[model samples]
Each structure stands twice: as structure tokens, then as C-alpha cells.
Target: PTAPVAAAAAALCVLAVSPGQAWAASADGPDGPAAYETAEGAKPVKGTAGSGDGPEISPGTYTDSIGRGEKKYYHVDLDAKSSAFISAVAAPEPGSRVKGVGEGLKIRLETVDGSECDGGTEPQFSAEGAAYPVADYATRLIGADDECQKAGAYLFSVEREGPETSDPGRWPLELRYMSEPGLKGGPRLLPGSPDSDEEPGDDETPAPVTSGEKRQAHGGTGFNDAGALAKGVWRDRIKPGETRFYRVPVDWGQRLNASVELGSANSPGEYPPTIYDGFGITAYNPARGRFEDDPFVSYTPDESAQAAVYTPTVDYTSRFDYSTNTPCLAGWHYLAVTVSPQLGKFFKSTAPLTLRVDVTGTAKAGPKYAGDAHAAGFGVSDEDKEQAEKGQNAAEGERSDSLRIVAYVGIGAGVVLILGLAVWTLTARRRAEALPGAPGTPGALGGPAGPGGQAGPDGGSGTV
Candidate 1:
């Protein structure tokens, strides 16, 4: 074969064998759906069946898979001075069937003595009957209660459950452990004050921002890669049985208003056109805690469906309020939009989605922490705002980008190696051809014998 052909073949073989390159090619293809992007350097750990007997998890992200009716446990070491938090995000594989409502994951934190830290959060599937990513966290607060306050070693347990007939595949989980430093002056509840003295009167609805031009924004499959958006209108597409995540930086004293509008779809021409409450939007606080329940809409193929959610102004005191946890912290609040899997029966293609976000109220100073709250993913920063404005994925982090770069360099090196091999082979062939006894020459090695012998196509010895 020619040198160029050999070099091309070698390069193709390298790319074909490279997992990262193959995955990247498929993921970027037109028909491929986006999969959840786990945290960079996320250690894969197996959770034990028994509490405190599992592997130890530190202040970082980890990945695992849990089956239904099974409990997975991991332990974390903590200091009594700083508050500790462990959040679990469970996502079913795309196209997996779910029982809806009661089917979901449960998370809890407890001391070795079996003292439960918090009430433990259970994030379940809604009435959508579709599988999407759901997350909740268990925290060991610094001075909230007397129980589990002195943190030496605590167990974090995750339980998955669903209906008897639901899909039995194991769901992938993303676990995060965070340590929030103690306050400078110790934990103290701040007095509650209304963000605005004059509240909007009853029956008054605030207008959404519609003046800005819509920019393209693709949402992430999970919180770890959630797309960042500021106060603007963004455009994206979502397929049936898919959920997309976007995060907005909410500073202290700021209130967030967001809505998602689904484009109209072709009617299936059934009597009393089917009505679905499966399309909706959900909100979560910085800790991956569910604060706002989904406000679902009766969706019909003939018309557009819109679901909106408004959050209270973010304040330090909001954490103490049990009435509503919408404004619990001033950080990157997540918005999750989902479409039911059942919709696939009627609409085979992805539907267009428009998102409108408005962040109101002036940003106020945040509380003082003994350690950096931003490092713990609690507070917003100028960099966060800039990233949102540029439509970057805030959760992708620098490590993920570095990994991608390394993969690209590996492919490049493979190509260079192929070229070098091709050059050496071509040079050796030229040197052989210049020799007196070259293989293809009439009087040379492997050449035809004198006059009566027939030569091969290249003047080498015939194979007859």
C-alpha cells in the first residue's frame, strides 16, 4: 500500500480504538441524546449494605449505582466546628420506564449511634411517569440541634424504590460531600424582613422580561453540568422522557422568576385530545434540596404549555423558615424542566423550548462565614455572573475541560505517530528501489529468471 494510504489507515485505527474519541463523535451526532456528565475526578465507590461499614467519602464528588429495594451506605468524617452536607442525585437511564409519583430515591444522614441528623429528604418522581434526575441532601448543621452535632463519623445512606412493575435497571447516582465553615460569630438567626415594603397587590402578575433577543443555550443532563443563565431569554430543545438543568446565580435579596414555554405540537386526532400534566418545571436550592414543587400544566398537542415558578427573595434568615424553602440560600439555584416519556408516543421529534428568567431586587451583602463560602458552592461571585452571561456551563468546572483537552492531545499524538511511521516506510522503500539487487528489478532478488521466465506484474518472480 502507498505510504499515504497506510498512514490514513493507522490514524483511523487509532480513533476507532479510542473510547473517548468514539464517545465524543457519537454524542455530537444529530441523533444522539445528551447523557449525564458526572463530576470530574468523581471516584467510583461501592456503597455497603450496612451503615458505617461502607467506604469513607471525603469532601468531593463520587458516583455509584443503586438498585430498587436496596440500600447503599457510605461514611464521612467531619469536624464539630464546621457544618457538613451530603447530597445524592439519582438519574435513570434515558428511555427507562418509571412508575411515577412514589418511585424515587431517599437519602439520610446519621451518627454511628443511629441518631438521625436531619429529617432526611426523599425526592420522588412526580406524576409525569417519566424518569428524570432527582436530588436531595442530608446535612449535619453546626448548632441546629443537640443530636448528631459532634461529628466524628457519620453514615450517609441512599435507598431506591419503585413500583413492582417498573424497570429494574440500576439508577446512576452522583454524590457530593460539602463542608460549610462555622460562622465568624457562631450560628445566629437573622431577623426576617420583607424584601419590599410594597408587595404586589392580589390579582397582579409581574411582567416577564421579553425585550432581549433570545440566545442559544443547551442545558445539561444533570446538576454537575447544568448550563448557566442570567436574566435573559434562552432557547433550547428537549425530547420526550428528557430533563434539562440550568442554574441561575441568585445573590442575597434577589428574587428569581422563571418560566418555560413548550412549542405547539401536532395533534394526534384523538377524541377529547389527551391532556397530560407531565410537563413542568421544578426548582432546587444550592444544596440540591427541593424547595419548590413542580407547577405542572395540562398539556395538549394542539396548544402550547407554559409553567412558571417564582422564588422568594434570598436571605440568610430564609434557611430558618420552614414554611417554604425556596429562598434558603444565595447561590446557584437550579431549574429542572422535564417532558414526560409518554409524550414520545405522540411526538417522535424533539420539541422547541423557550426559557425566560428574571432576577429582581438589588443584591445585598451576604452573611459572614469563618471560611470561604464560595469554595463550598454557597455564594455567588463575579466570575459566576460572567459565566452565565456568556452562556457557559457553570458546573462543567475546569477539571472536565482539562480532561477533554488531554483526550484531544492523545488523538493528535496518534496521528503524528502514524505520519512518522509512514515517512520511515516510504524512505526505506525508495532506498531499496535504488539498490542494484532490488526485489522488483530484472536481475535482482526475487526477480524473474533469464529470458524464458515470465515476470510478475512488478518485475518480481512469478507465482505460477
Candidate 2:
């Protein structure tokens, strides 16, 4: 075979064998509760005792740990032209204990001079005492009169607070820093006014889609690895004390409505008849900021329960409007659903969950960004839409090993076939050249003919 063909075959063979390594890398030992997946290549850093002395973190993801009642600080350098956001997620062990309403995580961003950039956020567990992932973000937006506008260096403080009886073990923390580019010029339009009307009742809510097949969507444990969901019915199973996260891509001018239905427990009569805070659903914006208060339903083992959230149309100027600020960003919005740990006392099996998502309104052109919003993880792309349609999970380092194996096998087979054909062609040409009256011989088709008016032994006509 030619050198190029040999090299190509070798390269393809390497590719065919490399997926085995990927399979090994992606494999997890036995299924337990899904854990929060830190961002790929997230730098591991330790927070300092003081804000000024903390290690400087860039605009990316990082992993750390925080103990009960401990405050950790890190630094970030910023510019005046872009808005910065830092999101922190605190994940306790699956079976750990937590307070019903006050035990969780808090985050705050401030300038080096001790001026608060934004009010801090604290996301706590529900009254169910379920130990799940809690997340919130702090931001420094560029506005006409906002603190931290002319920024140089800023500090981020993450604190874990819980009752003394709660678990004292340190919880894993996942932090992300995102920078939103400023507009090219000034505001394109004025911010919308807040709506004074009350939230719509269940009768007025948009009906869930009932026509399509329910797709399988395994939710992630945190925002970074949230499963992609579209406007459809998605099915998954959740255990007691488990929380799952899913994201839907909402463009400018689009409104999002989502709900989760918890199916009745199996063998309800086996346990007590007490009512519990059954299931809860929460919504968050692109920056991991909670948009609305978590809505939960009273759950009894004997019956099913459901909860839902509806958001206004996404607009860039909505950030300036206090009432509509949460859903203002046009990007991947998140939904987190949780099942109460109290269910475990009454049921032994995982409960069924149905997520219904509906996105309405025509997509509109977004505002002009002075920088690349996509690079900063702030805009939606065609790939994001495709993933949502396929119900693809975004967990880092997790992929379909079977699909990859099939692909590698196909590629390896194709390379072998090509090389085989090349070898066969080369061998046939050589054989023909060695044959009597073959090419380059006297009586060959394009070679000199044998003696005049005579036929060659190989049955080729001579000069005549």
C-alpha cells in the first residue's frame, strides 16, 4: 500500500480503539443519587480568610468545599464595560440532614473598598428537610447609577449556614463566573413596567401538551449539567431527598411555562397516612438567580401532586424593571424539581416525575452585544435547541458509550475496506503485467504488435 494510505489506515485504527478509553473514563460505579458535576477542567482553589488576601479567580468555573458556618472568600478582576455574575451551588451528601427553611448557602459580591455590588442571595432547603443542591448568584451590572460600575478588583464571599443539629460535614461547592458584554451603545428601548395583576390561577394556566410521546430526560444535579428540555412532556424517576435540574432555551420575546407532576407512591397503604410537603418546583434565570419563590404542593402517598411556574416574555430591558427582572435574560432558563425526604418514611421506591414544558411567542432578534455573548455562555445556539429536542443531558464527562462504540466500529470497518480495495487493485495490475501479452508486452492492446498479419499466443491480433 502507498505510504499515505497506510498512514490513513493507521490513524483510523487509532481512532477506532480510542473510544474504549472514553468508555472507561465515562463509566461510573453503581448508581446512587446523582451528584453535582463540577465544570470540566474546573480549577480547584481554596478560599481565604480575608477578601483582600484571597486567590484571584478568573471568569470560569471552580470547585471548593465549605463547612458549616464557615465563610470563604475569593477575588476576581473586572472591567467597567461588562457585567459580571458569580453563581455558587452547595451540594450536601445525599442522606445528610438539613433544616427545613434556614439551612443552605449564601453568596455575595463586593468591591475591594467594601462597597456592596449587589445584595447577597441565600437559597435554602424547603420545609421538607430534603438535602439537595441549593444555588444562587450575585451580580455587578453596569447601569446609570450602580455600585461597582468602575470596577478593578472584586471579592466573592460564600458562606454555609445551618443549625447545630444539621450535618457538620463539609459540602462540595461549584462556582461559576460569567461576564455579560455591555450593549454596543445605550439602551435600545426603555424597560417594561411591572404588571400589577396577580398570578393566574390554575384554571387560567396554559394546558400541558398531551399529544406527543413522552421523552426520557434525566436531569442534572446542578445548573452546569442540567439536562436540555424542549416544549414537550419529559419523564424521569426521582428518589426521596433528590433534586433534579433541567434547562430550556428561551429566546427573546419568548415566554416559558413549566410544571412537574409527581405520581402516587407505590404501596401507599404500607405506611402512615400523614401528609407531607410532597414536591417542589423552582425556576432560575440564566445566571442561576432564583426568579420566583419555589412552589410546593401537599403530597400524600395515596395521590399524585403537581406544581407549575409561568414567566413573562424575555426582554433585555427587563433587568431594569424590578418586577420582571428575573426572566429578563434570553438564554437557557433552569427548572429544579425536588421530592421530600419525608416520602422515604412512607415509600420504599422512587417516585415517577413528569415535566411539561411549553415555550410560546415568536423568537425575536436579541440586542447587539459589544462582545461575544455565546463565549460567555449567555446566548442560545442551534446546537442548544437540538439538544433540547433530543433531551440530551449536559453532565460533564458523561456520554453514550454504546453510540461511540458503534461509531468507532463503523469508521474502522470503512478504513479497512478502502485499504483492501487499494491492495486488490495494485495486486491485479502487477499480475496482469506479468501475464503473456499483457500491457508492455508486444501483443498488448497499446503495445507494439507481433509479426505482421499474425495473432499472438494470448489471442491478441498482430499488426493486421
Candidate 3:
């Protein structure tokens, strides 16, 4: 998963945001108004500049390992003073000018195995651990963490506080960026499709596993539910004994065919499978709506065999989706989900119903997609595959509790053995007191317990 990423060559030229011509009286000039933190999204600051963990450039857009792949992230921050009410700052496109207008300000990332890899939520760098903005990074700061595997470019968009009244040029951001891998992508999806893309859940099977160096993680899912978002919607419903497939939308970045394991099992061994993408159905608020057009694509990385298990409810559930990370080449045609054998059979309805179509790009209007029908990757040995699955299944439902149980059982058995040894020692002492004196009790206590748990102390007792 070591993808070679290209830096702008010049750090200053990387961002294409334009300095606006308009500004409030006090918030005028290129070095306009000092920012203020209203009790909003990302607290706005009144000043810029400080010292803190700086932003880092990642190696690749994605990576892989163990039960999963594409396991890296990035960390960036800045020490600056501002005067506008800054909500959460957006990660914009590579060189977009209009920032903070909710346009081009999206933080999108995915995994190598097509799981929705996430960045740290509410992770920060500032003067204090408390949620406070850095007045300046030359001394104080503001920051967030991104995934850190292979290299990739991150785009951020900006938005100033207020009801679209003041110009953004009035606020100055003294940003400092840094890179850290110890952060997190949090927890992501299982390998296979478990529900309608509308309502993703845990009761599904685990995806395939990984080998070589396995990474240890301690983060949870950061399902971005901020702003106006629709949590549930119906994707595709499978009737009894019916099966449907999907095509991954990689935008042609894939070398081979892409595929997602789809099913409708009540549990792992259950049957009547179905996989569908309901990403198009989910809605977002205006502030975060610009990214709504980006279809969730599975970013598959190089890995051995792996599978995800989960339960699919009638509602939709979304998994390994899209990412604006640099790994996604602009204009490449990626595949989404396609119903195989035949589109969903309507046991309840016969006439073909038109499904609403959309695209990650605003220009193109096409059928909503998910993953591909073909499997792609380096095959895994059966033995290694099994171990990886054990981890994946546990991870999907947040079931590390089972691992805890196993550890306690081992400890319990060890305690039992120790107690048994103590009991045996005491029994031998009592026997000696009762009648086993060396001279008089020779026949009575010749052996306590031999290898076979028989006879006396010295060895097995016999007529001798």
C-alpha cells in the first residue's frame, strides 16, 4: 500500500484559495479581522500564530494489513489568530480557491479493502486539553488527525461564521500542520455487505483477514452524523431465495475488477443474500451538502483473502465508501454496484420502477452504484484466512468482550491447577499425621500419588 504521492513542490502554492476583496471595517486587509469562537461547530478564534503539532503529508492515499488494509492516516494543525466565527473547517480539493463557503470543503477517506476509513473525531492540538481554539500556533494551536498509511493529498474547505453576511477574506488562519500515525482511522466496516446501503449494522460476517505485521488499534467508528443527515432509508429489498450483486465505483482507478461480498443472513451462516448501495438516498445539510454528491466507493488495497459478515435489515446500510484522497485519480471511471443474474425481482411489484441516479461529480448523472461483481486481490492461504476472520468478526460488532472472556478462562484454569497442588500437599501432611510415620507406617504411605494417581508418596505401592 505504499503509494507515491506528489506534494505541490511549493507548500505555499498547494492551496488555491483566493483572498477576497471585501472585508468588514475592523476585519479589513489581507491580514483581516481576528477570529472569535462562537459556540458553534469548530470554535472560532480571535487571533492566529503559535506552536503545535504541524500538518504532515502521507505516503499513499491508502494501505492494508491483518484482517484489513488501507490502514494509514494523516495529522495537520496550525497556530493562527482569526476574528470570524469558524465552525468546523473543511478539507478542500487540491487547489480550490473558494474555501469556507461549504464548497470543496470535505474530509473524505477510504481503506484499501473498500472500508470507509475514518479520521480522528474531535482530536485536537491546542494550548490546553480543554476544547479551546489556539490564539496562535507560534505558541498556541488548532489541529486534527488523518489516516497515515500510503501517501495521498488532502483537500480542505473553509467557512466563516455568520449567515453568509461577511466575506471570509476578513479572517486570517495561521495554520500549522503535522503528521502522526498513532492516531486512528477509528473502526470501519466488516468485509461483506450486510444490509441495504441505507442502514449499515454489525450482525454481519467479518471480511477476509491479513498477515505479516498486524496493527493494534483502540479507536471506534466516527460516523459523521453532524448537521442534517438522514440515518435510515430503504435500498434494495431481497425476497425469499433471491440474490443480487453490485459493482464498486472506483472511477476506473482499479486495475482489475472490484467486488463486494453481499448477503441477507440473519447471522453469518444464514442465507437469502442481498447487497445494495443506499448512499444516494442519504441526505445532508447545506453546510456539508457539497460532498453529498460524492458516491461512496470501496477503496480496495492489496491483501490476501478476507470476508465481512453482518445482518441486513430491510433498511439501508453503507460500508466501504468513497474518498477524495489523492489515490482517486480525477476523471477515471470507477464502478459501483450492479445487480447480477438480474436486477432485484419484484415479487410484490412487476413493472420496472426507475431508481434515482447520481454521481460524485456534479456534471454526470448516472445510476447509483456500490462495488463490483468481480473479486480482486492476492489469494490467501486457508490457515491464515481463518485467523484473520476471527479478528474481523470480533471487530465488526465491537465484540472484543469475547476475547476478554477467553483470557479470563485461561487465568481461571491456571488458578485451578495451583489450588489442586495445595490440596495435594495438605492431604499428604494429614496422612502422615494419621498413620504414615516412616518406620511404623511404611506400608500405609509408600507413595502419595504416582504418575497414574495411584499408591503412595515414594512410588506406586505393591505387595513388595
Number of the top-ranking candidate, with TM-score as the measure: 2
Candidate 1 vs candidate 3, TM-score winner: 1
lDDT of each: 0.77, 0.77, 0.23
Give residue 152's lDDT in candidate 1 (0 to 100).
88
Return the lDDT, model 2, position 203: 24
Runs of candidate 1 with Cα error greater than 4 angstroms are 1-33, 189-205, 270-272, 325-327, 395-464
- Candidates arranged by TM-score, highest first: 2, 1, 3
Tens digit per residue, CA lDDT, model 2, 130-174? 777788888877773467888598889998988899988999998
TM-score (C-alpha, index-matched) for candidate 1: 0.76
Whole-model alpha-carbon lDDT for candidate 3: 0.23
Model 3 over residues 1-464: C-alpha lDDT tens digits?
01111121122222222111111122322221112212223222222111122134222111111010111233322212110011132211111122122321112233233333243122121111111111111001111122323333322222222223222223223222222111122122112322222222333333222222322211111111111101111133322111122111221211111112233222223342332221111111111111112222221112111122111221111212323211111121111221121122312321111111122111222112232211111111232233223322212322334444544565565456556656777887777667745534544445344445555665556443
- For each candidate, give its TM-score against the true structure: 0.76, 0.80, 0.24
Report the C-alpha lDDT of model 1 over 1-464, residue by residue, as the tens digit.
Answer: 46676666666666545543322321442453455678878999999998747999998899999988889999888887787778898888767778778888888888888888763888887755667788888877776654877748888899998877887988888999877778777776434454642263321335777978999876888787788898989999988877899999988877778899988787877643655675888888787777656676777777788888777767766555566543367788889998876677566878889999988878877777889999988988987887688666754334344545665777777677777877888899999888987867657757665555666445666545
Q: Give me the runs in candidate 2 sitting further than 4 Å from their true place.
A: 1-32, 186-204, 270-272, 325-327, 395-464
TM-score of 3: 0.24
